[model samples]
Target: MIRTIDVHKSFNEQEVLKGVTTEFFPGKTNLIIGRSGAGKTVLLKILVGLVTPTTGDIFYGDVNFSQLNKKEMRAIRMKVGMLFQGSALFDSMSVEENIRFPLDMFTSMTWKEKAMQVDSCLERVSLGQVHKKYPSEISGGMQKRVGIARAIVLNPEYLFCDEPNSGLDPKTAIVIDELIRDITIDKNITTVINTHDMNSVMEIGDNIVLIHEGKLAWRGDKSQVLESTNDTLQQFIFASPFLQRLRAAALERSQEG
Candidate 1:
């Protein structure tokens, strides 16, 4: 699990995260949701050691990440996998090569062994047939799948996804969400996702953290979210016409039943 205690971050004179505290449990799809500028991205960066908080502690399992030295941080980073917002696949490399990048950088394994590992990761992401394809040759969803494959190739203990569903159709987005959740459970990885997509929230939000204006507004499971009395959360969630309609219909059905 990943836990942040009283985390605070500031840029110049402005504080972006205000004493945010939360835990991202293992084997679950832990979601950080908020509007733009809510500091969800900053928090994710802090968890992954991209940016350090001005104050507070970050724990990976029982180890305090905040106190790690450079070498220690490098070791911890080796155990981390990140799926970036844009899929972030290399345009110059084939799918297999992209998956092999981490193994090459981090391991002393032979070429044959690395090939085997790359193939296994591709199979896991259901992209085994596109080994020779470059990023431009694949569909957006397939590119995202390749990104996921590369992320998990090293068997990372923690996975971080930034807007995993961004720019995909609804069907594809749902598929990606399911894939991420299934992988998390199967690997028991501490998975943290920074996303504003409500569909993802309802689909795979085993643990949900709502950040509003840099502060933690609420934290709970998907079911608890539906029944929450937190006005700010409700307002943000129901602000979408589609979600508003969904809640209204759900309420009507509940009453009729």
Candidate 2:
């Protein structure tokens, strides 16, 4: 699990995160959702050590990560995996080489061992074959799967995803969401995702954190979203007319019950 204690971030005169505190548990898909500039972006950066918090600490398990020195942080980072918003696969590398990049850089595993590990990750992500394919040779959804394969290639203890479903069709988005959820549960890894995809929220949001104006506005699972009376959360999640109607029907059924 990862915990942030009274975390804060400031850029020049403007404060981004304001004394925020939260815990992201392992073996579940922990989601961070908020409007633009609500500080969710900054918080994700802080969690992954891209930006240090000005006032507080981040903990990985029992270790207070914010206090770690650069060398110590690098050691911890080897156990971390990140799935970028754009897939971030290199155009020049084949799928196997792309997945093997981390192992090559971080591990002294023999060539055959690295090949086996890369193939295992590719199989885990349900991408058999296409080893020789480049990023451009595959579709967008396939590229995202390749990203997932590469992210978990080293079997990281902590996983972070930024806007994972940004540019996919609804159907493909769900597939990707389910893939992440399954991997998290199977590995029992601490997985934190920053996403705007509502379908992901309703489907795999085992632990959801809603940030508003640099503070934790709300926290709960998918089931609580429909029944929640929190105005900020309701306005954000049920923004569309279709969703509002769905909420209304659920409320009506609740009253009848």
Candidate 3:
């Protein structure tokens, strides 16, 4: 699990995150949702140690990540896996090579061991046959799957995905969301995903954090989200006509049944 306590981040005079406090539980898909510039990305970066919060503490499991030394942080980072917004696969490398890159950089595993790891991850993501293909040769969704396979190759205890469903069709996006959620439960990984995708929220939001104007507006599960009375959350979520209708219908069906 990951927890942030009164976190604050700023750029020059502009504060991006304002005293944000939240806990992301393990074995679940923890979503951070907000509009652009709402500090969702900044929070994700701070959680992953890519950016330092100006004032606040972050805890990974029981350890206070904000207080860790550089070497200690590096060790924690090795336990982390990140799937970038764009899939971020190397254009030149084959899928196998891309998935094996982490082991090559971080482990002393032999070629055979690395290959075995790569094969396992690819199979897990259902991309085993595309191992020899380059990123350009596959569709966007396949590339995202390869990215996910690579992220999990090390079997990280903490997984972070930034806008993971970006650039994919709605159908493919839902598939990726379910895949991430399933892997999180199966591996019991502390998974954190940054996205504004309401579809993802309704589908796989085991834990949801709603950020508004750099502050944490609400936190709860999917069921609680629909029942939440927070004005900001309601406005943000029900702003879409489709989601509004869906929520209304769900409420009505529940009442009638």
Candidate 4:
């Protein structure tokens, strides 16, 4: 599990995160949700060591991640996998090469060994026989799967996904969501996802954190979302007229029963 202790971040003179503390659990999909510029992105960056927190601590399985030296940080990073918002596959590289890139960069595995590992990851993502295909040759959804394949090739202990369902049809997005969720449980990885997708919240959100104005506004699972009376959560979640109506209907039905 990963835990943040009263973390705060400042950009020059402006503060972004303010004493935010939370825990991301293993074998579960932990989602960070907030409006744009609500500091969610900054929090994720801080958690992954991309940004330095101005105050407080980040702990990775009892290790003080915030205080780690460069070498120690690298060791922790090796066990962490990140799936970027755009899939971030190399356009010129084949699917196999893309998946094998991390192995080549980090490990002393032989070419044959790398190939086998790549193949295994591809199979795990339910993609078959696309080893030689370039990113442009496949659909957006396939590229996302390739990203997932690459992310897990190292069998990381922690996984981070940024907008995993972005830029895909609703159906394809759901497929990606389930794939991430399943992989997290199967590998028992501490999974943290930075997303704005409400579908993802209700579907795979085992732990949910809502940020508002640089502070943790609410915390709960998918089951509690609809019933939550927290004004901050309710305002952020039911911002749309359709969703407001849906929530009202859901609440009314629950009252009737």
- Top lDDT hit: 4
Higher-scoring candidate on TM-score, 1 or 3: 1
Q: Output the TM-score of candidate 1.
A: 0.97
lDDT of 4 by residue, 1-257 (tens): 99999999989999999899999999999999999999998999888998989999999999999999989999999999999898999998999999999999999999999989998999999999999999999999999999999999999999999889889999999999999999999999999999989899999999999999999999999999998999999898889999999989998999999
lDDT for residue 92 in candidate 2, whole number 0-100: 86
By the TM-score metric, which is better: model 3 or model 4? Answer: 4
Q: Please, what is the whole-model Cα lDDT of each candidate in the order they appear?
A: 0.92, 0.93, 0.93, 0.94
Among all windows of 10 consecutive residues in model 4, the one with the lowest summed lDDT is 41-50
Q: Kindly report which residue stretches of model 3 are placed more than 4 angstroms away from their true locations once superposed.
A: none
lDDT of 1 by residue, 1-257 (tens): 89999999999999999999999998999999998999999999999999999999999988999999989999999999999999999889998899999999889999999999998888888776898989999999999999999999999999999999999999999989999999999999989999988888888999999999899999998988878989978998899888888998997998899
> Which residue pairs in model 2 clash with each other?
none
Model 3 local distance difference test score: 0.93
lDDT of 4 at 102: 92
Candidate 1 residue pairs in clash (backbone atoms < 3 Å): none
Predicted structure 3, TM vs. truth: 0.96
